[model samples]
Target: MSAPEPAKKPNAAPPVTRPVFLARATYRQRRMRDAAALLPILGALLFALPLLWLGQNGGEARTSHVMIYVFAVWAGLVMLSAVITRILGIGAAPQSASDDAGAADTRRG
Candidate 1:
């Protein structure tokens, strides 16, 4: 005959669950996020400009100059975007449930 299974503990606590909150962006936050999303595209366009100009002109010295400018501009744009996001506090924490409930109460009244 198979062995009997061990008895379960009756004092075990159930798993505790907290509410999950999502961060909803405001209009300005949305706009800033959109701008951040576009940074790479803008950087690519900026990088291409000098390359295109140098490709048409075809000078060894000009080619080097344009390459340097491209790198410098690309780096500058990355830094600028970092600064903008930092100043805007783009990743601020979401409001807590209590805070949200309080705001809703104030609005309804």
Candidate 2:
């Protein structure tokens, strides 16, 4: 007689995991928020870059050039923040007149 076959191993359950991809709108919103969160850090790093030039070329970097760079970065950051805010629907109008009325009533009460 042939040797008895080995007992079959039980199947293990697959590991739990999140979906490989998020919904399109959700993914866009998350990326936008991430960009907003990182903006300040980016701005900080950019602002600091001018300091590195202080020691270069015997410190001959012009003040006006640095000022222009700083202002340009500032303006760019502002524009980026505005675009992100608009996309995120921040500062949007109230959904309805009733919502505004309710808020006013609560404030008065």
Candidate 3:
């Protein structure tokens, strides 16, 4: 009878291989990203204009031009996140599992 093959070492590293996508969801993700990209520019304008006005009127205190830019960037990110959430209908779940979960978790004796 042929001898059995010895077991390999436990710490033997696995070979690395690149993943192949059967079908990429590229177009939808691209569309969502493109839609999301529009948000930041609009948000920056919306926030910066009011801040610039405040600066011009000497109403804004303790904020420099650089600070204005930072605030504008933050506002832009917030806008983009909001846009993505709304576009993806994140909070529009149907009355099902979430409701059941809430009911289950609510002060059950």
Report the number of the highest-TM-score candidate.
2
Candidate 3 residue spans exceeding 4 A from truth: 1-30, 33-63, 97-106
Instruction: Tell me the tens digit of each residue's lDDT in model 2 across 1-109.
Output: 9999989768978779999999999999999999999999999999999887864568667899999999999999999999999999888985888998999999998
Best by lDDT: 2
Which residue pairs show collisions in model 3?
none
Note the Cα lDDT for every prediction shown: 0.78, 0.91, 0.71
Q: For residues 1-109, what per-residue lDDT tens digits would candidate 3 score against the true structure? A: 9999999999989999866753356656667778777776776576666445554456664457757777777876887788787766668868888899888889595
Residue range with the least summed lDDT across 10 consecutive positions in model 2: 52-61
Pick the winner on TM-score between candidates 2 and 3: 2
Ranking by lDDT: 2, 1, 3
Predicted structure 2: lDDT: 0.91
Each prediction's number of clashing residue pairs: 0, 0, 0
What's each prediction's TM-score?
0.48, 0.71, 0.38
